[model samples]
Target chain A: MVTSAAPRHAAPPVHAGPARMTATPPPIPTLLDSDVVRPAPPASRAIKAQVENFSFFYSTVQALADVSLPFRERAITALIGPSGCGKTTLLRCFNRMHDLYPGNRYVGRILLHPDNLNIVAREVDPISLRMRISMVFQKPNPFPKSIFENVAYGLRLRGIRSRSELEGRIQVALEDAALWGEVKDRLRKPAYDLSGGQQQRLCIARALANEPEVLLLDEPTSALDPIATSRIEDLIVELKERVTIAIVTHNMQQAARISDYTAFMYLGKLIEYGATAEVFQNPKCKETEDYVTGRFG
Target chain B: MSTILSDNPVSGGIAGSRNGGLLPPLRSRSLLGRLAERFIESGLLLAAAFSVLITGGIVFVLVSESLPFFRHVSAREFLTDRLWTPMFADPHHGIMPLVAGTLTTTAVALLVAMPVGTLIAVWLSEFAPSRLREVLKPALELLAAVPTVVYGYFAVDFVTPALQAFIPDLPTFNMLGPGIVMGVMIIPYVSSLSEDAIRAVPMLLREGSYALGAGKFTTAMRVVYPAAFSGIASAYVLAISRAVGETMIVAIAAGQQPNLSFNPLDPAATITAFIVQVSLGDLPHGSIGYQSIFAAGVTLFVMTLGFNIIGAVMRRRYRQAY
Candidate 1:
């Protein structure tokens, strides 16, 4: 659909012919200059998951209003906005994380294709769905069990009780999260004994053990130190080769460094979304530009 | 710093000391004020020591009173004999029957209270909604505030009659009746303390479990329960101690007979009940019968003290730092 409201950042690809340059690309209007109008790019990109005209409410308060975006497969999509802008809310909708509470209502459809399941459908069981689309929390929350048992929890839920199989899978998941070397000698030790960075890595390993199709991270490094944050950022980059990732982060540089696509939300609305490089360097909406340029949140 | 303190009482002592690199001196105070401060400090210390002094006094009394009874009757016979007829014409003051009676009633109370109390705690902390929890928690705790004599009456009038229908030969006053009523009395302690401990576990842990695809039952039983195990165990120990020290219910409903039997339906007299029996009757204050209560009191104190210590150690050992 050729809606004129395509994110100003994702302008239609420049025509190859030099003759079209003379027409002058439609000028973006400054706040002072209101007469200019520009056509936005078509929202017809191939997508792994499509949030179609979706809105959400917590009791009577609307948290997201008719947000629509494409989550591409095998790539990192970062949801960035100021606090209470509904970025985390949109990320949680991907895995139905809000199902934990009562009176949290989802309206419209979040159609996840290939699997062809609308995640918000009443018939869909949240427990089984969570196995396919797992989540990581803001703070590191490893179980009080041993590191081995913490990593084995998800696998055990699926009934993988054989010793050799559990050991092999635990090793592989820990290695994938880049934590096996530090914790290999202490697999039987309680998880709380690990350093903060190591604990966060252990949580990542726990999620990896399940091999979910999509991984949702909700500000996974907010409680971490700088060194731990960088390590988690690197892990997120490496993980996208196997699993689709949807992350909610307030760190713009981290998003610019790691994500392929970025969706900027404001006041529960998708203000702009496109390739991260383009959205950062050249935002289409005035509000998007202001947020990326650090003028205002 | 001295000048600042004398000039400005509004500036906290900390700020003056921090900036000046010297503590505000108290020596400049009037002699009378200094003396008053010293007196106050000692008064507070004495108040703290008063509890220790009382504990020591109880030990001294028990040991001195019990020493005379042991002189008349050997410690070996008093401890090993199955019969405990201290007031009889040919008295054979064995402590076995009273000890057995205390254990039987305590075991019955724990058997009835542990599972039911823990289940109620789990339901309150994990399953109940906030609105329901607000109403139910205080209502359940109100059971503990009911006087023990009232529980005794209820046990005799209500519980024994109920049991008589099924057993057909239930006694009027038996260990089972008081034990069941005592279990009901102890339920609130177990449930309230366990609920507090379970609720103390961080919500982050529950969210972690849910994020890992665990259902609510798995989250509650596997994760939350283990995290709160020490607290729940301590609650159990405290509840058991409360049951052992319980007096009025057992004295009224568990009979005055000192039978050395494990049969809960049979009439028995717990240590507390025997102490009550001896204290209420007319006997010379210094007689062997009167002195026997002190020995029993010492045993009861040691048992309850052991339980409280165990509870304290468990609380320390399993405390989660987070």
Candidate 2:
């Protein structure tokens, strides 16, 4: 299943076995050479969004430095990095979430495909741009409202006031988020009454209500239990057929289980980017290999 | 329960000792210490009861004084009568005109305060820079600290003249001047309380709205305002009650004449203004005029109490539990 997703990649090298992963292996001198090459990704996938030479800053401090990568259409791309490594920062740049705060700055172009609009450009209004690229936060932060209203919030923002239209879209979004079965009978109940897992799905339903092309998840299941984590992982894998997804996760197992493509970032640089199997099993960079092999975060 | 108690070795030993000749410790207290503790407890209880006691006393006085006025003037007449001319030869004790005066001024005040105050609150919460918020919040609060009488004078000397320019025939002492000035006086209350409520709305909710492509205005009005509905509504209701009970402002600027006119340009007397008007005069203690103050006081008390009840109900009804 993993190999078919990126058929151009050769078979996984035998030396890349987990048992061979070492903490004290001598650094390869060939890797230090500029001729170090990364495996090419399959050419079948279309680009959904591109971050070109993107640098991000919070007030005076720079968060991401010259980071560039392409998100494949209808594919799940997981951003893996330690805390404060610009993984979440780069994810937020896709939908311009940083524009809400005053001092945070996006210093490079993030081009959304088809029309090729730079998300951080002067002409694009962050408010309207968000409709096409919605985001679910780190914690399941559903509005303090009913289950139905929580899912319907984004639709209401778009001025869809008809009862039938709202009910229809809300049903679809909830069904898509796989929360309709448990919550359909008590849609009027407050979202807070739901467990942590249900609330996270409700948030996903909220983002899906806008019919966004790309969905960003920032450490979505960090607050959930193991059962909820696997449920969300399964939901992400299924959702990739309909929407392009970029998730920032600290959990390497979650990234490996769900994402088709993976980007490893360290400090502020894009350390590695390729098909998920290649990045995880046959990492090109020493930092990527070490981090993926569990030598260090 | 006995088996559970016996499960603890320490308690079982104590129980065994109790069954023997040993008695529990007396925890002997000095007489002075006992007295002091009792005295402090009584003092605390008295302090807790003081407010209820004062409220009961006020109700007793009001009802006792108002009974005599109701004897001459029927309860129906006092409640339903259009005129309120107790000082006149005929001595009409109708309070509707005073009520109309209070309602008119409160309506006018709310008209000015509600929108302006809510907008100010939104700006302070969502838009104001940190340094600007630090400066603006205390400055807005200073408006509330100004004495009502000072506000009354400002109404008469400044607001009345400024309004008179546009409204040429506007009375020198009209409900509009005091009502507008009272609105200004209570702006800080509405703005500060509502600002606190709006600010208390979780940042996550606002971020959720923004992520859904909602503009700042949309988020503030649709999400933040509704999320903080109970607090904002209660703030407005409390402001309205303050406007209704405002004495010095209406007493000075709103004329003593109990005109039952709805037009704000005309001079009118609020229930509070009438109380102030009657108290300033040298009437005998048991006279109808003297007793009429308590009747009006009772009316003002009931009206303000109703507002408080409504505000409390609103605070609970729409409270968005995070």
Which residue pairs does candidate 2 place in steric collision?
A: none
Task: Please give the lDDT score at residue B196 for candidate 2.
Answer: 93
lDDT (CA) for every model shown?
A: 0.84, 0.85
Candidate 1 per-residue lDDT, tens place, B1-322, comes to 6776666555565575676856653335668987999999999999999999999999999888899888888989988989999899989888989988999999999988888899999999999998999999999999899999999999999999999999988999899988989999999999999999899999989888888889888999878988898889999998999999999999999898999999999999999999999999998898998899998898898888888988899888777666
| Model 2: per-residue Cα lDDT over B34-134, one tens digit each | 79999999999999999999999999989888999888788898988888999888888889999999999999999989999999999999988879999
Return the lDDT, model 1, position A74: 74
Off by over 4 Å in 1: A1-46, B1-57, B73-75, B168-170
TM-score of chain A of each: 0.85, 0.86
RMSD of each: 8.1, 8.5
lDDT of 1 by residue, A120-158 (tens): 988998888888887888888888789999999999998
Q: Provide backbone clash counts, one per model.
A: 2, 0
Q: Return the clash pairs for model 1, or none.
A: A8-A284, A9-A284
User: Can you tell me the DockQ of model 1?
Assistant: 0.53
| Residue A278 CA displacement from its true place in model 1, Å | 1.5
